[model samples]
Target: MASPDLIEQRQYAEAVLGGLNIRPFRVDLTDGLLFVPKSRIAVVRKLCKHFDWPFKVTALTSSS
Candidate 1:
């Protein structure tokens, strides 16, 4: 399981990414909400659970 903060963050992300059909990647915890479609979000989540760290599984995009 991820840390409390990490879990919270992940939950928030899942909620935010709902039905978007996006792909997320791990890029370091401090990196912020920047995801790339190259890895499975579930894999990342499982990894996070295994490593006990927050995972980044959302597509990174720029705001106009």
Candidate 2:
């Protein structure tokens, strides 16, 4: 599936990613984006919601 064709949608996404100085990456499902900034994680989460995409945060324990 793909997002609808709309300029505003693109601009909003670009602004969000730009503000966080980060990028949205999707190389594969199992091998997801790595090392996204903690500060930018929230924005990523919100964008994922707005776009109806799944954004998952894997919690790590010190033992790992």
Candidate 3:
């Protein structure tokens, strides 16, 4: 189950991204991560920069 804080964060993130026409594929509140399509990374990064949000890219592995 998602925690209340996580749900709030997810909604806020969705709203922010939606305004920019960027839809996140997944929101991992527990890990404090947001996953978007590979093609959207550049734009996401730009938005993150504009908002001064920490942006990181992690490669997913078969084991992960």
Task: Output the number of the lDDT-best candidate.
Answer: 3
Instruction: Kindly give the number of clashing pairs for every candidate.
Output: 0, 0, 0
Task: Estimate the Cα RMSD of every predicted model relative to the unseen true structure.
Answer: 10.4, 6.9, 4.1
**Candidate 3 segments exceeding 4 Å error:** 1-9, 54-64
TM-score for candidate 2: 0.41
Question: What ranking of all candidate models by TM-score puts the best one first?
Answer: 3, 2, 1
lDDT of each: 0.51, 0.48, 0.63
Clashes of 3: 0
Clashing pairs in 1: none
lDDT of 3 by residue, 1-64 (tens): 7678667756776788888787545556667666777778777767656765443533233333
* Cα-based TM-score, every candidate: 0.35, 0.41, 0.56
**Local accuracy of candidate 1 as per-residue lDDT tens digits, 1-64:** 4356865766655554444554443344455443655445565456546655445456444530
Estimate candidate 2's alpha-carbon lDDT, on a 0 to 1 scale: 0.48
Tens digit of lDDT per residue, candidate 2, span 15-46?
66677667442212333322245555666776
Give the candidate order by descending lDDT: 3, 1, 2
